[model samples]
Target chain A: MTIKGVLFDLDDTLYDSTTFVDRARKEAIKMMIDAGLNATEEEAYNILQRIIKQKGSNYGHHFDDLVKAIEGQYNPKIVTMGIITYHNVKFALLRPYPDTIKTLIELKKMRLKLGVVTDGITVKQWEKLIRLGIADFFDEVVTSEEYGLGKPNIEFYRYALKKMNLKGEEVVYVGDRMDNDIIPASKVGMHTIRILRGKYKDMKGKCKYEVKSLREVVDIVKKLIEEGV
Target chain B: MTIKGVLFDLDDTLYDSTTFVDRARKEAIKMMIDAGLNATEEEAYNILQRIIKQKGSNYGHHFDDLVKAIEGQYNPKIVTMGIITYHNVKFALLRPYPDTIKTLIELKKMRLKLGVVTDGITVKQWEKLIRLGIADFFDEVVTSEEYGLGKPNIEFYRYALKKMNLKGEEVVYVGDRMDNDIIPASKVGMHTIRILRGKYKDMKGKCKYEVKSLREVVDIVKKLIEEGV
Candidate 1:
């Protein structure tokens, strides 16, 4: 069990994605209210929140739904206002947790190869890394969209291991979701670290390690490497 | 199935609780950052959000945990600042959805008994109704704490129906959580309407009806009453 590489999840693993999205969407709702949708700011906010809850956080037609719900039709002006406000607020606020950079640096210093294996569009995942200023820390970054495969697929984990020039048992995969990160990685004989955060925190899964923060991963990696794993 | 009374859940059923809590918690984190916490505002915000996610929304010692996570000790001043900011922001923003009052009024006009059967402390749930200005709309309000019981407990549904002088089959129970509202009511022979909102929206459960808005409940009640249920 000579651990060579440590992989991570992006959203909710290294950053405060829930807070960022909540703030961004709330600001977007305010912009919609100011644009004369004939509702109070809170009413507009609730409507948008409801639509997001129903559709999901990444749904592209949020503004379209917002306009229809508030004004009974799609007003491009209002939709544009909302989209601009949401993106502006979200991008401005996107940042890694305080311990993220320090922990990554510490892991890198331990001579363990670091990489990110995320499930998202290629550009969006790369943008997140660049925005957080941690793009250089990874030896490799694999996004399912770019790889033409998604997580829970053992092939994706195998691909990441191959890119790192390491065997499955020699790398540790860390992610927030059990189904996406832990189960498949474990299936491939890779030691899995389930970071207890994000949407799937409550989901049950199999993993060799479970930690509350990325900072905790440093200690676990150190122990495993010291013990020849 | 003739409906004599309609019952509803409080949080997220009558109001947008997810948005409400997110706004309040973020404001509280900001207050923590400003009040001599060593971390940046984003760091403080992330720490608090993580703790909330781990401990749950109703965990009583959130401020204690926030202070411990940021400052490494329990400082009453920081705790007080966080608590005051969180409560002020939450109380100021608490209000029902735009259609809540209108729908309640419409149901009243239909000459049907209306009530709220919720699981929470007595004063808190009552305060929400009062703050939303819909306290007078309900002929009866039952809190699990007041009744010495909680939801999914058949006794709770039985109590609300008994208070309204109605049989179980003559009442319709609407709630956001299927476990708390739909299943138990259904078990008691009450027609259940699961409002597709809140934390439990995606959960599977048995119910006689499902709706996206409180306003939709008015139509459901009208049809049921007209059909002589």
Candidate 2:
């Protein structure tokens, strides 16, 4: 099939979400201390990180759960401080990787349908695109919120294929995860490119392409078109 | 007396606090709405900006007051969201002006004491210097919190002079405000230079000198030493 479209995972594929998130989290802890939290910055951050690890980043109410864990009950002052600090810093520091914009621009010149298939809150994923100043670049955005299902679900990848009105073999799927993003999309019969960065960089994943940066995605797409892969 | 030191204001003079604070405020309002505030971004920002104006930026409870004013009573969820959102964005966006570092470095090479004197919470002011990575450049940081007194008060200027162990005439004071910074320091017999930027950019202030940027301060100090003024 001829390659004519590209689908992307928002977080690690387009941007280095890990480093900024780390700085924002630390700043949040410092601000929590400033907001009358009883615990030290180190103690509070360690506990929060533990909770995030256990509950996952999107379980909702991480701060709400964190304050209860720390103080043995819900404390409005403490919980609010953590919530405000974490998100404000998070969004303020939001940015795409250096190569993301140029890569996207180059892909657009290829006359391809560009879309985002992300597992995150609908508004927040949209907020990420908007803040990164790349919202207008995409033709469609498919979030887990819209389907009430997320990655690793074979149907989710199929749904994105349908949204772009293209067959799986006609497009390339690029993301940074093995279990949920790469493997599942590969099963859906799409050309899958796993960006070897972020949390899953060390995890070995079998895919059509294992590249280090977004810039390479453009060339792969060009080669696929020329070779009719 | 020969000039031997320089004292500066923390905000406007040392950095372009206005631009960053404005961006951070707008981002805070956007995040607040995401956190479940009922108002639109424009409405929330307008109300918050008004509150900051009325109570002044240093008012400790702007978010708490905003929640009360908006919902007609205290709502912990909404209030906490605003509080966490505003502060997190504010601190994340903190930055120094482009010329601030080079000017400080040049002045340090000339062996000036290089101190900061102005108003606001001591800890918060210290946080600014630290976040901007310019804390080591200053020999002293005198905030209103130290003496429970702020600018426009001649005694505060005198206190800064005493701390540096130099007569008022032997030091140069650089600040953006005419009333609180320039006039008082001038009254105390110091050389005063007003940076023509920030809220006071257009206001005509009578001082020993006025300049468009911090870069000019280095030249002024050089001239002072050469002519022994």
The candidate scoring highest on lDDT is: 2
For the predicted complex of model 2, DockQ is 0.02
Model 1 residue B15 CA deviation (Å) reads 0.7
The CAPRI quality class of candidate 1 comes to: incorrect
True contacts kept of each: 0.00, 0.00
Error of 2 at B32 (Å): 18
> What overall lDDT goes with each candidate model?
0.81, 0.82
Give the total clashing residue pairs for model 2: 1
- RMSD (Cα, Å) of model 1: 21.1
lDDT of 1 by residue, A1-229 (tens): 5888898878889888878988898888787677666778778778877887899665668877878987887554456567767877997899998889999999889888999888876656766776688877988888787679987798998888888888988888788888777888888888778888866788876566888888888888778888986
Candidate 2, RMSD to the unseen true structure:
13.1
CA shift of A25, model 1, Å:
41
Q: Estimate the overall C-alpha local distance difference test score of candidate 2.
A: 0.82
RMSD per candidate (Å) reads 21.1, 13.1
Candidate 2 lDDT tens digits, A123-207: 5676677668887688878889777899989898889999899999998999999998888888888898999989888886577
Q: Write the per-residue lDDT of candidate 2 for residues B1-229, one digit (tens) a residue.
A: 6889999998988887888788877776676677567788887778888899899888987876776777687544455455555566777777788999999999999999999996887656766776688877887778887768888888888888888898998898999988888899999999999998898777765777999899999999889878887
